[model samples]
Target: MNKIHYLMNREVNYTLSKCFLTRLTGWEEVPLVKTDACGLVLFRFNNDFTGLRFKLVLNDIEILTAAHIHLGMRGENGQVVAFLFGPVTRGISVNRGVVTGIIVESDLTGPLQGMSLLELARKMEIGNSYVNAHTENHPNGEIRGQIKRF
Candidate 1:
């Protein structure tokens, strides 16, 4: 697993390019847990004529986001391969398909911690940060999530 840490002093933006997508592994049936501070925002997309795009909302706003992921492969084949995120509210299930981009917002006014950067941000007890996910698999770099905090 990769790890990235930031003693954030300003707002940061992370982007996922096509090359980044090619290197992403271990993204199957991953459970995105919500923490006391941050939340996971997943963007769903499709290539079909009637392609669908929507946000998979987690049920509870305060449930800590944590889970072990089993990454899988996606191709031209059209199948319902979605990563089930959060133990959200009753009847409000959150899932995304054919992820095109993901960006995590780390709103920090102090220090942070967690299993991964996302986990740390989620569990953070300070400012607001958003993790925008285009794919379910967490990216690898000097830090996790390919993030940059100013």
Candidate 2:
């Protein structure tokens, strides 16, 4: 069965290490990093699900910032897929057909709207790649995710 695993501290580190320049500046925040960057947090997902973005509603098409899902480790192929959920247009199907949901950091109030783990590839799912600034730049900075066990 497909597993939709949310982003975790461990997974965030995995993506940062790949960036040749991330180590020096640290994996903190690279101001200029948009949801469009190669990594998960770099840029927003196609509809939002591809990155660590959050989902606002289940039945309707809505998304929020702050994706909880973490980018996974790269496999033999760095496969990435963007599953975005924008406002539905006229002549479009709703409440039924597959309407890709954008990932976001909303609370339990919001849930994913599109492809499940079984439907998508391992590397294409949403992962942690959210940043605060828009134009700021990182010369070796990074955004770290800390984890504590109970």
Q: Which candidate is the best by TM-score?
A: 2
Model 2 agreement with the true structure over 1-150: per-residue lDDT tens digits:
123244453354344322111111123332322232222222222332333322222121112222132232311111123333321232222232232243333311222234442222222333322212111232221222211111
Give residue 87's lDDT in candidate 2 (0 to 100).
19
Give the Å error, residue 109, model 1.
24
Once fitted onto the true fold, the runs of candidate 2 whose alpha carbons sit more than 4 angstroms away are: 1-70, 73-135, 139-141, 146-150
Which has the greatest lDDT? 2
Model 1 TM-score on a 0 to 1 scale: 0.17
- Compared with the true structure, what per-residue lDDT tens digits does model 1 show for residues 107-145? 212232112233332222121222322222222100012
True-structure Cα RMSD, model 1: 16.2
**Model 1 stretches astray by more than 4 angstroms:** 1-54, 57-70, 75-85, 93-150
Name the lDDT value of residue 8 in candidate 1: 36
Error of 1 at 18 (Å): 7.6
